[model samples]
Target: MLTVELGEELLIIKSEQPLKVLSSAMLNPGIGRYQYFVNRTVDKNYYPEDAKCEYEQFLQQYTMPLQMTVAMMTAVQQRFVMREQYVDGETTIDVFITAGLGNAVDVTQSYQYTYKPAVGTINIFVFVDGDMSDEAFIQAYHCIIEAKVKVLHERGVIDKQSGTIATGTSTDSVALAVKERGEFHAYGGSITRLGALIGKGVAATLHKAIDGYDAYQKGELR
Candidate 1:
């Protein structure tokens, strides 16, 4: 089983066993086997010239083996983070997301706006209780990205600079983790069962997170 803990400034996900993880996170990125993943919340105005150093220093507060953890940071508040679980027989997937659209963007367009402190970001963390090959893991990651973009498009999220549907925020990030146990999967795509579950879980969780953030912005939610 996987456990999720929310702190004032952090969200932590720990698995009963180590997992094969692939992520584009600021801390402990890339493909690795990990037992823990984290999303730390920073102030919306927080920005550091050396983000690498900032991540390293922030991680020092934890006692877990840093190498066994994958971590990402976001400006979204912890109260707005959302989670969803999808289960199909023996397979289970958990999706956790924190989203803010202030920096939404259309990837095909270019902008020359001055660099500013972080205001918004969308960070996704997915945990699957299944064994997947390296190829399948990469495919699952791609599927998650597709789902996110689809939801943004459907929601009519527009980029301020391009006036077009945003594919994602400029600082968006995701981490996909698959357990080392369960029936091995060779392919993970929208058509496959594993990928389908992942896609649905991410789409639902992300949508809810965005809605929650919107409410927060309007003072409808705290």
Candidate 2:
């Protein structure tokens, strides 16, 4: 099972048991066994000379196992975070996301200049029940990124610098956690059931998070 908690400064996703995780988080990046994943909300103007120290300090507030946690930071408020879950037979996928487009960028564009302080970012955290092979874990991560970019394209998100579709924000981050139990799945792709669930869950949650952020920006949501 997975539990999600939204606080003023943080969005936390906790699994009942330790999970094998592959992540691009600032803290604890790479494959490991983790039980807690956190997305910390920082100011839009946040810029730190020592990011590692910054993350360490922010994480000290919680009593969680610091070494067992994967953490990412975003400028989007935690209140605007969105979540979705899909369950089929013995498989379950849970997705949590927060999005902001202030620093959107096209992956194919090469820019000499970029936004300073990088105000916006998209952070995604996904937890899947059951064991997954290392190869499948990486494949699942790719599926999540693909789903995110697809939604951005469908939404017509533009990169102001390149005047092209934005693939994602410059600081986008994602984490995939798979419970280390049950059958060891070997494949994760758009055509696979597990991958389909991941894609669907990520796409749905991202759409809601984007819409929610837009509404908040326009004073439509409080």
lDDT of 1 at 209: 93
Write the residue-wise lDDT of candidate 2 on 67-96 in tens digits: 989999988889888888788668887888
- Among residues 3 or more apart in sequence or in different chains, the pairs in candidate 1 whose N, CA or C atoms overlap within 3 Å are none
Query: Over 4 Å off in model 1, which ranges?
Result: 111-117
Question: What do the candidate models score in CA lDDT, each in turn?
Answer: 0.86, 0.87
- Candidate 2: TM-score? 0.95
RMSD of each: 1.6, 1.4
